[model samples]
Target: MSETLEQRAAPAPDGPEQVRAAPIGAPVEGSADEQLPTPTRRANPFRRALAGATEVLGPWARVVWAAAQPVVAVVSGLGWVVLGIGFLATLAGFILGWSELVFLGFVPLAAILVSIAFLFGRSTFRISIHLNPSRVTVGERAIGQVLITNPGSRATTPTRLEVPVGFGLAEFALPAIPKDGEHEELFAVPTNRRAVIPAGPAVSVRGDQLGLLRREVRWTEPVELFVHPETTRLHPTAAGLIRDLEGLVTKTITNNDISFHALRGYVAGDDRRYIHWKSSAKTGQLMVRQFEETRRSQLTMVMTSDSRYYGDADEFELAVSLTASIATQVIIDQVPISVVTDRLALRTHTVTSFLDDTCRLQLAEGTFDTPRTFARETTKRLPAPSVVIIVAGSQLEAQEYRGIQRLFGPDVNVFGIRVERGARASIKDVAGMNVMTVGALSDLSKVMSRAL
Candidate 1:
């Protein structure tokens, strides 16, 4: 909800309303609903109104009276002499002892009726607008539609109505209704970008026989459209295992690999399948079948997004992109990565449902915001055993250095990536850990290829 109507009824000390808002078309308490902006067709806005009176009056219906204003003044001026004649007739009626009042009243009554007859169309109508795909995937198309209906018993006057389009939505106008009737139209929506698309409003004017009295009716039906950013592909290849970092892709199966660890001596209650024949023959002791550890590998990913050039959009957007890519990779690789952030889960482990769309995310200004996000998130968890990578700004950072050592442990490698604003970023190792960092988005393909 925006500010209350009372607060916005007038300008404040700051001046006019900075953000523009469309007006409500009907009463708020009415059954009418809000119009969502959608994509649709284009119709010429200035078409003329089409009423029975318009056909009779032709193109000059609205202006006929105005165009003939001078002639009307002349005629009406001469008609004043009829008032004198009426007075004399009334005087004569009085002198003849007949009623004078009736004679005087009929002249004025006839003149009033003639004046009313000059006015044209007399129908009432309502306009309805609709927007489709109220919500959309990034880059998906949205649509809009407009409907006009005459809600009267009598036919209409010659009228032209213009509907506004495109603040974020498009607008169209319809011609006047001859009798009671309907009209429809369309337009387009820009995809995946966040914006407040608004359609201007409509303009309708009614004509009279004299054309002197024109009624310009303004309509305000507002619609808003929102565009989310598109989904992009991530690094295709797995990263090479860095001796220093936590998350590296390596082929060698060991205590660290997600595969089988080894076989051991069988104990009481051990299943018969646990006995190893070859090892039993050599050592004269039974060895149980070895299996890989089912436990999830511990992972910690730190991102410092303060690039010298990363522009001002949504800090959270980039954070989300990076987090989604990394988190998904961890799950796919069979590693359980935990994300650190404030105000979310105190701790995330074992790649639970929490990691799905809600990857620990934080968007802020400056380099420390990244580390701050991490420090704030990992409150309850034990230290991790898998690789640790810190993706930060292109510039050297203090927290990156401190965070690496603070989170460091056995077999843990920490790596850093520096991103320059508006330029290609690459993954590079800042600490002894294989911490991979990139400055440019263009180099993403090359960096990703190495992992494959």
Candidate 2:
């Protein structure tokens, strides 16, 4: 006989099918239409009571935490561990009736209490951080001064001040200062590499000798020290890369432009303003003027910051210096320029701002790994350029250079600068693009002059 849908779906009562046990308080897995057996186990009473108490004491716990924040900030990590041990030992000693553990615990507890007294006083002083010549080239000496003046009427107490200089910290011991007296601390920052290093927001630290607790008070705001790449000075004219008043002329013909090329028969959609009346009268046909297209001398530079394209840090640094040197000369000439990397675009409004942005450039793995992809993505965001320069390390293959050149039209002048340390500097033509290999920074001017 055929069975009904309900009978087929339901489990047999006398079959070998075993019911799996679900976790306590978890819903049993079964069809909603069918009534399932309830779970026999109940939740533990202790856990249920603890949860209820936690819900009732939530507000009180928050209040306690808020009050303890100051103490928590001042207490060091070691202080917390010692405090915990002290309390646990004291409690265990009372329960076990052992005097030795109680005495051992009292030592740390007493020391922590005594350490709190060291952080009692306040610091009131005017502080200022001054970096002499806040911008410097790599391997140059960058000096900074911290001036602290006691503005209060009474004498100031002795304290220790910590000034964070890049990755290192500088500490100074300030003696007692009379009213209206000033103290000066000088420090030198290491500028071995190109980077944007933060100098200070000088902080005064008060702590005991036991290393239990510390209180820090910030006095001054932090300032950035720009360690720019060492760049060479290119020629003022950039080897005919920039035309003074008139823009770069291209072979593309346009109906209206500054440079006239030839005359042609008027098309259907020709502009009426460009019609050559004299030529039309002689030829007995509607003739229009055609002119060669001219684009404003806009230079767009793209540098690859991908680590995979660089052999070492020196090669990347050389590439940066080469890019900066060329871009700086262009900026000095007041030409329209845009400098970009695989990661971000740099500001090119002024020479100082341009070099300052280069100080923060770093090599990393990015979305556009190859020159072709980097150029393809970058060209969309910029305007049509008369000159395009691609800067990269020596690790960039020859095929990649050809791929980059194909992205732009024949009208756009494409140049590639490949930086390779300790290699001979030379310029070669790669698929109609001028590819220059630069070994050292001093060779940039000679190579650029030859290439351009």
Candidate 3:
């Protein structure tokens, strides 16, 4: 063989010149056991000391901080501002020997003492609250009644009552109640939208006319007023795709089932009991029976309440109304239905309860996986239904529909409704899943009629 220039220039493998020809950075082969160990950097002593100190004093320091939190809160408000100014003025007046400044400072000091005394007095009146029809629909009225009773033998002095409703407070002044007497106050419940309004832990606030020394006494328990989403009439015939209990028999064949489907030529290994004797005699061959496949028509509604799934709060409200309309119509149809909304599986015992749950449902933070994935997993654990309807926000794109399609096999029918505000309503098939968009609540029935 002819020696190439490159080969001639290469170092000899088994020669004494090889060691001397090795490059400065060239690696020397060694057995795994003989290899040098990697070096580790030393940790700083200061960091170690800091970690040790944290471990020792962390719990006690937390306890002391927690103990001082209430004190800090009490002095953190405007009360502290007034108290600080008064203290500084009093000190300066004493130092300067100014009688007018001293008198001025003493006035504030006296006011502080009186305010403290006012805040410290024990509240004598007992309060109880009652909500008429605690759950109501939007545009409906709910009355909240507050009863103040004097439980003690002695007469109860009149005081101001403060009840928080939504973002505002309703105030009332009570008259002096004789021994064992009671007084009642009624307030209107605001129903601007679907919400859970905290009626009260009736707070009685006592503050000086100067807006100093404000104190609150909680006399009643807090109650929730659920305002359900308003729903329009959505015909069940248009909304439901399959009939409940006994739906149309599928063309697919099953070996042994309840419904009598069809008859075919018997194979050698076919079950002998299923053979139709009359048809065999007429055809002069063994005929086997085939039963039509039928499934109990059940509806599953998966609603997404994650804020990230919606373009805005209005979109979410539209989604909720759409869900409520369909679900309400399904319940009216007397079909088995399951409603799942972001992490909450609503109880479907009654239409009213389900509506209540929808009313109380709030937008939740998004999870690591999308809402569709969560719905798919939840559906898998449930008994497979004949129809699956997903009510998602308009934020879902065609790609998400592809992901959602993998959850159900071809045997079941799946429908998707994307709700948007002020958008045109339309329906089309996306990745084998029937999808529709609803712009308004009333448009749902029309859209479903076209889609179904």
TM-score order of candidates, top first:
2, 3, 1
**337-406: candidate 3 lDDT, tens digit per residue:** 8888767788786888888788767777775278657777667667677787888787877667667766
| Candidate 2 colliding pairs, count | 0
> What stretches of model 3 exceed 4 Å from their correct place?
1-76, 95-101, 119-124, 248-252, 264-275, 280-288, 368-372
Task: List TM-scores for all candidates, in order.
Answer: 0.44, 0.81, 0.76
Instruction: Give candidate 3's error at residue 231 in angstroms.
Output: 0.8
**Model-by-model lDDT, in order?**
0.45, 0.76, 0.69
Measured with C-alpha atoms, the lDDT of residue 211 in candidate 2 is 67
Instruction: Estimate the TM-score for candidate 3.
Output: 0.76
Pairs clashing within candidate 2: none
Whichever of 2 and 3 has more lDDT, that candidate is: 2
State model 3's lDDT.
0.69
